[model samples]
Target: MDDLFAPSDVSWTPVSPKLAAVRRVNAAIIFGVLAIVALIALGMSLGWTYGVLGLLVVAGGFAWAWVLIGRNQRSWKYAEREDELLVSHGIMFRQLVVVPYGRMQFVDVAAGPLERAFGIATVELHTATPATDAKIPGLHPDEASRLRDRLSALGQAQAWGL
Candidate 1:
């Protein structure tokens, strides 16, 4: 039987670990909001009992979210083949998207404020149809640009309509 858990023949390139930093930043924001809410509720005479319990639950959830985010970042990967590019992610659901070079219309590299601050970028692949487009996130800026250019060149050279 084929190995169900093993990766395929194509060698996948894993995303930058710096993505965890972005996720941590987002988790920090959520915890901050929760803290403010708890403070407001306590200040409004909502009783220290409920306020403290709510804070504890929210704190636990925040910790769990960090674990999930770390797993997700570790799972995210992409590979380029002779005919197509593959993007795969998800710790449980296992999503894999294949964007044929021939169907690719363009590729873009983008970084948001947090991503830029972390020196990482995301590459978006646009196929002839919106349904086939995909994104690979958390790559170093230089790698993202290189991937964007390579995909663009390959797409132009081998473009075949969907």
Candidate 2:
């Protein structure tokens, strides 16, 4: 049915460009590690006729990770309304998750060493499921805190039926 494939009835907003930059940095670091491992494997496989296959496998891994990073940078979206907050992302398999304000347990604004270097913060929404959580990254630290405060307040108000 069309409904099965159609996008959900949810508004979406793109993450800040700064977020993409941060993700790219992370991807580069991961790719560098993979390259090193691949080189080591290639050296070990030399003269065994498996070097070519190893190289190909490593190249494919790099390509796959690169594509995944690109998709993550492109597909991430966030939206919040009085009733709920939504985060949607993924390239190969799209995902859209909605969290009602009334169901939110807490909100946290966090900045890791890398994000701090880029003047960015991540807002995490704590709900019942740790797996199906919400994270909005690449916000200015102040902005992240403000959003956290607003969302927490909204959730509290909603709980009280205000």
Candidate 3:
């Protein structure tokens, strides 16, 4: 089963560990706000009992999601092969996507505000078939730029019309 998802020959490059930290922080911020709102709203309208319960429930949800986010981050990996790029991720239901350079139409690099603050970016490869397109996130900005250029060059070299 492990072999099924493992890269063929090239080594797998795991996303930066900082990815987990960033995601956890995002989760914490969202959950924290929800907890605060729940505490205030429930306390004001439904009494302190429900307020306390709501806070507890939200806290538990954050804890659960925090662990899963770490696991999911650890699962993300990518590898560049001679002809294709391989991206694999997910914990419960794993997925592996292979995008051939010849079939690539273009490449894009994107970084959200939080991602930019964290100095990380995502590289996405577009193909004629949307199903074969793939994105690798949590890469350093420099790495993402390098990948985008490399993929664009490769795609042009191996150009296969739509």
Candidate 4:
């Protein structure tokens, strides 16, 4: 099953471990807030029984969702080829994106509040068209900057069609 997205034919660079923690914490926080709201609503409208049951269901669902989020985050990977960059993700429904250097107009690396809290960043590649753009997320801050620089250099060096 792993071979479907990550084959031995090419190297795969895994996302940072901090990404899993960030994802887990984010999921927990979101579900925690929703669970609180549900408990209040159900308890007031129906009774304590419905509130308790709803809380338990929300907790269980949060656990399951956290597990799935971790799995999905771990499944993400990116690789750089001579002429293009390869990004692959997903456990069941796999997606592979190839961004050619010749098509790349610019490269950018950014980090949001959540990602900054975890010391991770994302690198986005902008091609001639938005449809062909590719993004690699959950990379270490330094790694993301290095990738941005490398891709920019490669894009310039390979800009024969541009």
Worst 10 residues of 2 by lDDT: 1-10
On TM-score, the leading prediction is: 3
Pick the winner on lDDT between candidates 1 and 3: 3
Q: What is the TM-score of each candidate against the true structure?
A: 0.91, 0.76, 0.94, 0.92
Q: What local distance difference test score does each model get?
A: 0.85, 0.75, 0.92, 0.88
RMSD of 2: 3.3
List, residue by residue over 22-108, the lDDT tens digit for candidate 2.
Answer: 877887787677766666777686643565566567667767776667667777777776588877767668776777898788998
Off by over 4 Å in 4: 1-7
Q: Higher TM-score: candidate 1 or 2?
A: 1
lDDT of candidate 4 at residue 104, scale 0 to 100: 90
- In the range 108-132, model 4's lDDT, one tens digit per residue, is 8988899999899989999988888
Question: Which tens-of-lDDT digit does each residue in 1-162 have in candidate 3?
Answer: 887888567799999877888898899999999999999999889999999999999999999999999999999999999888899999899999999999999999998888888889989999999999999989999899999999999899888542
**Which stretches in model 1 have alpha-carbon errors above 4 Å?**
1-7, 42-45, 160-162
Order of candidate numbers by lDDT, starting with the best: 3, 4, 1, 2
The clash tally of candidate 4 reads 0
- Candidates 2 and 4 compared: the better one by TM-score is 4
